[model samples]
Structures are given as structure tokens and as C-alpha cells.
Target: MNIAVVTDSTASLPHELRTEHGIVVVPLHLVVDGQEQVEGDDVGTDWVVDALRRKVDISTSRPAPVSFLRAYEQAAKGGADAIISVHLSAAMSGTADSARSAALESPVPVHVVDSRTIGMAVGFAAVSASRDAAAGRDVDDVLERLERRLDASSVRLLVHSLERLRRGGRIGGAAALLGSALAVKPVLHVQDGQVEPLERVRTASKAIARLQALTVENHDNLPEWAGGVDIAVQHVDAGERAQGLARTLADALSTKVETTRLSATVASHVGLGTIGVAMVPRIAD
Candidate 1:
């Protein structure tokens, strides 16, 4: 079967890579200044980060089901016999549900995958699935590949504060870390589709160190597929820091790293000055 891969904007896959892999991206909605805007390519990260710094009240909405329908239709028109619709974690947003609703009405067979993680964590799976499809793999094989990615991948976040998370009501499993000393920096990761506390450090520097250590440890612990991995360093209003972190990770793993700026939808919840890494420890078997 000719399978197609689709993902939401929050995956934050770079345009070049998305195009190269032929992954279809559906954008989520961002409400800014009383207007609805699509996140990702439409609203530039630079402007969103700057607006957040200026205290703009930016909010996000899950992509409407119609958006997914259009994306699915486009993929079908392109001659796809089936579609693997991957999206951000269900615990994080309703984007996956929206995709599922569209899947039911899609012309071709649609398999909705709740990535259970966001950013490059989801991007990694989508790209892998796309590669599998391009190689003439069937839907079942592509789905199995995504399952392995979900099992082997991890994402760590160095959030600026818990205040934004709490305010946004997206704290999920990290709620326990709240009401602590303001100076403490919380390192978070996705656990079973919810943000959970990974570690808590006394300062931002310590948090950065902890993140770096975690990346190195995870990379070293990978199985045979270690040689082929996806590592993404992402930040909001901290591009220089992310670039530096990416360089350190590349050196530690002896592999190249990808860096991306978080979209406004993500920035609205994670807050500013957040830096993190998402990695697929190894290629799927």
C-alpha cells in the first residue's frame, strides 16, 4: 500500500526536513491579539518569542477537525492508499482527537497515532514513518515503526518556571512540583502522555548541566541503532543557548544535532528562556 505520513505543527519539524521526507504538516491555531493564527510556518518564532517577552497574551487552540480533513484529502489526492496521522500527545492537546475525527471521514484508510510526546519527538516518528512508506512498506509495518519510536524516544524540558505551566493548566503530572521555592528550576519529561517531573535543580545552570548529563547518558545507553538517532535542541527566546547545547550534545554523541525554535503555541505554555532536548535513542528495528 502507498502510505502517507501526517503530523501537526507542534511537532516543530524543520521545513527542509519535512519537505525532504514528504511529511504532511497540519498547523494548530494560535490566538494572538484577538485573531486566530496558524502556528509554525505562519507565525514566525522570532515574533512570537518577542511578543511573549513583551507580555502578550498569546493562547493556543487545537487544530479544527476540518484542517485534518483537508490534509487527509490532500494526501489521498496524492495517491496514498493509507495515511498514518501522527500528532502531539493527547494529554497535552486535543489535536490528536481532531485528527481522529478527520480520520473517520477520510477517503483512504487512516491510522491515527497519538505520539504521546511533542516537538521533535513526534517529528522523529513522522519522518521515520514517511521513510517507511516511501520504501513501499505497508501500513502495519509503518505503524510498528512508530510504536518502536514511541517506546525508545524521550523528551526533556528545562522550563523557566512552573507559574506559566500552572497558569495554563497544562502542568499534568508535574503538578506536584509546584508551590516550591521560586529559585528551584524544574526539569520535566513526558511520561505516559503527560508532563512529569524528571529532576529539580537549585538553579538554571544546574538544570542545564542535568539536561546535558541526561542526553549523554541516554545516548550512551542506546542499543545497536545508536549510530542512527535523532537529537533536537529546542528553545524559546534562547537560540544561542540551544545552539550551544546542541553543539555539546553533538560532541558527546559524535553525531550531528538539529536545532529549532519553539512555536508560539508551545511558548505560551512553557514560558520564555526554556531550553530542552528531544531524542530518539535509536532507529526502530
Candidate 2:
């Protein structure tokens, strides 16, 4: 049976990679205040970011069931007997739920997976699966690779501003105030499947240094630390800096780097200058 893979725009995959592989990408809506703006439709990343800069309501909406249904239908026509719908973490958003519901109504059998991470973390899983499928692997193999990567992965995000986060209800107004006062650069971590604060520094340079230090410490401790594993370096409105970050990380880890720009959708939440580094942990039982 021919197998197909599907995912949402929140994955923040690069345009080149998405185009190379025929994976179907569904977009989730962005809610500007109470009004709903469909992903890639009524509102885009620029619109959301501008609104946030102006202190406008910056709410995001979950993908509707109909979106998944459409992708499933197209996959079915392309001779897909089975489909794997991968999405952002359920803890962060209800995108996975929409995929599950759409799967139930799909013409082809569907297996929905919650990547449990946003941006390139989710993108990595989908890319891995699509590559496996392209090589004539079965659906089970694709799913296994995805799950394994997630199980052995680490994510670190350096958010430059807390105002957007405060407005989004991620950080309390009080905490945001304290964070700003202390120059506390909160080091957000992705553990198990949720985004949480891991540490806080007093400067932007320190935060970037902290990220590099962690990569060196964790990766060096790995049993199979062959120079470096795949590092997906990303940032919002920092594509130019993305290259420099990648180069610096490569020098520190002595490994190759794959850098990409965050889609406007993810930037709406991470906000501007949010630098994140994600890597699959050293293989462990």
C-alpha cells in the first residue's frame, strides 16, 4: 500500500524542503483577539507580528477538522492507503485533536501523531517520516523513526521579549515584569512534550552562550556523539542571524548544521528574535 504523510504549517519547514517532498501542509488559524483569521488566509505572520508590536490581541486558533479532511482526501487520490498526520504538541495547541477527528472521517486509514514540540522540532519528525516513506518504507517504520526522534530530542528557546508571551497568557503579567527587571533571560526547555522554563540569564549574550554550553555538555556526554547530530537552528525575523548562529554552533559542536527560518505562524508566538536550537538526544533506552 502506498503511504502518505501530512502535517501543519506550524512545523515551520523550509519552503525548499516542503517543495522537494510532496508532503501535504495544512495551516492552523491565528486569532487576532476574538476574531479568527485562517492560516495562510485572512491573516499571516506579518499581520500577527505587526499586531503584537502594536499591543493588539494576539490569539491563535486551532486547525479545523475540515482542513485535515481536505488533505486526507487528496492523499487518498494519490494512492495513499495509509496516512500519518503529524502536528504540534497537544499541550500547546488543539491542532492534534483536529487531525484525529479528520482522520476518523478520512477515506484512507489515518494515524495522527502529536509531535509534542513546535517549529523545527515538529518539522524534523515530519521530514524524517517523509524521507522514510520515500525510500519504500512501511507506515510502521515511518512512525517508529518519528517517535524515536521525539523520545531522544532536546529543545531550547531564547525568547527576547516577554510582552507577547504575557499577552498570550503564557507568562503572567507579574512574572513578565519580574523577568524584565532582573534581566532574566528565561531559558525555555522542551521536556517530555511540554515547553517550560529551564533557566534564566541576565543578558542576550548569556542566553546564547547558555544554549551553546548546553549543546556542548549534552552532546559531548552522548555515547555516539560523532562531532554532532542534526541541529535545526531557527529564529523569528532572524534569518540573517540564523546563518551566524548555525556557524557558531557548528564550531562549538564540531558538527554540520541545518538552519531554517521560522514560518510567520510560529513567529506570532515566539515573537521576534526568538532563537531556538533543537537536536535529537543521544540514543538511549
Candidate 3:
């Protein structure tokens, strides 16, 4: 059976990779300085950063269910027997809810999956699902593979400012340090599908070091080091730092690392100078 893979733009997947895997991405909507812009179409990481620098007010909204319905319709028309719609964590946004709502009306079966993480973490799951789908796996097998990767993945984000998060009401467990000084960086992670406090550091350098240490620990503790794992370094307007971290982790783990810039939908909440690493441990059969 032909199973089509779909994910939101928040996955931060590169255009070429999505095209290569036959994955369709539905973009989130963003309003910057009272001008509405679609996530991938106009509002991206650079645009969000620039708007923030100009003291512009930025807000985000989840895509409507119709957008997803249209995508499902198009997929069905393209000879897809089914669709697997992957999305950002429900705890963080309502994008998954919209996709699930659309799935109910799809002509073919549509399975909505919550990646339970954002950025490259979602990208990893979507890519896994797409690759297996391309390999002629049935819808059930493709979903199973995606689930295994989601369960094994871990993400850590280092944010320079938590103000945007607090304003967006997505601070979750990190709310404990809301009153902390602006210079006191916070290290957050996805736990139980919600953004939780991992720890707090005084400086960006220390936070980066902590992220590296976590990457190393996960790499060493994998069931089998040779089984292979995927590492992704994602950032919001922190390209240089993300590249350096990707290089270091790649060398230490002796594997390649994928680096991507966060999309506007994600950057709007995380603010600028945010960098993180997502590690998906290799799951054994």
C-alpha cells in the first residue's frame, strides 16, 4: 500500500530532504508586526529574528484543519493509499489537534502522530516514517517505526531568554525560574511531552558544555554503539554556535550530524540565540 508521510513546518526539515523522502509539510501561521505570514512561505528563522530586533510583536497560530484536509485530499489524488500526519507536541501547541481533526474527514485513513518534541526531534521521526513508507512499508509498520524513534529520542534546548516562553504560556516546569535574572540561562527539555526544566546555568558557555555532555552520555549509553543513531543540532539565529556544536558532537560520536535552523513558528516562542541538540538512539529490533 502507498502510505504518504506528512509533518508540520515546525519539524525544521530541509526542503531537499523533504522532497527526497516524499514528505509533505503543512506550515504554521505567524503574524509579525500585524502582518500575517505563513511559516515556510515567508516567515522563517531569519525573518523572525529580524522582526524581534525591530521590537515587532510576533504571534503564532496553528494551521486550520482545512489546510490538513486539503493536503490529505491531494495525497489521496496522488495515489496514496493512506497518510501518516506527524506533528509537534500537543503540550506545546495545538497544531496536532488541528491535524487530528482533519484526519477524521480524510478520504483515506489518516494517522496523526505527536512527535512529543519540536525542531529536529520531530524531523527525525517524520524522516524515519517517510523513509520506511518509501520502502513500501504498510501504514502500521511505518507508524511503529516512527513510534520507536520517538520513544528513544531526547532533546535539550538552551534559551538565552525565557521571556518569550513565559509570554506564550509554554514555560511549563520552567516557570519556577521565571523571575531569575535574564543572564541566567535556562536548559529545558521535552519530558512526558511537555517542556520541562532540565537545569539552570549562569552562562551560555556552560549551557553549551552541558548539552555536549548530555550528547556524549546518550551516545555512550546506547544499547549498541555501532547500531547507529541520528544527531541533529537546531538553532534560532545561532548558526555559528549550532555548527560548532554539531561538529564537536559529530567527531565525538564518530557519526554525521544534521544541522538545521528553527522555523518561525518555533522561533517565536523560543526567541533568539536558542540552540539545542536532539539525539535519537538506535532502537533494536
Score every model by TM-score: 0.95, 0.88, 0.96
> Candidate 1 lDDT, tens digit per residue, 88-175?
8898899999999998899998999988888889988898899888888888987987788788889999997877778778898788
Model 1, C-alpha of 146: deviation from truth (Å): 1.0
C-alpha displacement of 140 in model 3, angstroms? 1.4
Candidate 1 backbone clash number: 0
Query: Where in model 1 is the C-alpha error above 4 Å?
Result: 224-227
Ordered from best to worst TM-score, the candidate numbers read 3, 1, 2
Ranking by lDDT: 3, 1, 2
As for TM-score, the candidate ahead, 1 or 3, is 3
User: Where does model 2 exceed 4 Å of error?
Assistant: 33-36, 41-44, 170-182, 222-228, 281-285
Taking the tens digit of each residue's C-alpha lDDT, what string does model 2 give over 90-139?
A: 87778899999998899989999988777777777787778778888888
Give model 3's TM-score versus the native structure. 0.96
Q: What lDDT is reached at residue 112 by model 3?
A: 95
**lDDT agreement with native, every candidate:** 0.85, 0.76, 0.88
lDDT of 3 by residue, 57-103 (tens): 98899999999999999999999999999999999999999999999
Q: Indicate the worst ten consecutive residues by lDDT in candidate 1.
A: 40-49
Worst 10 residues of 2 by lDDT: 170-179
Winning candidate number (TM-score): 3
The TM-score between candidate 2 and the true structure equals 0.88
Q: Which candidate comes out best when scored by lDDT?
A: 3
Q: Which is superior by lDDT, 1 or 2?
A: 1
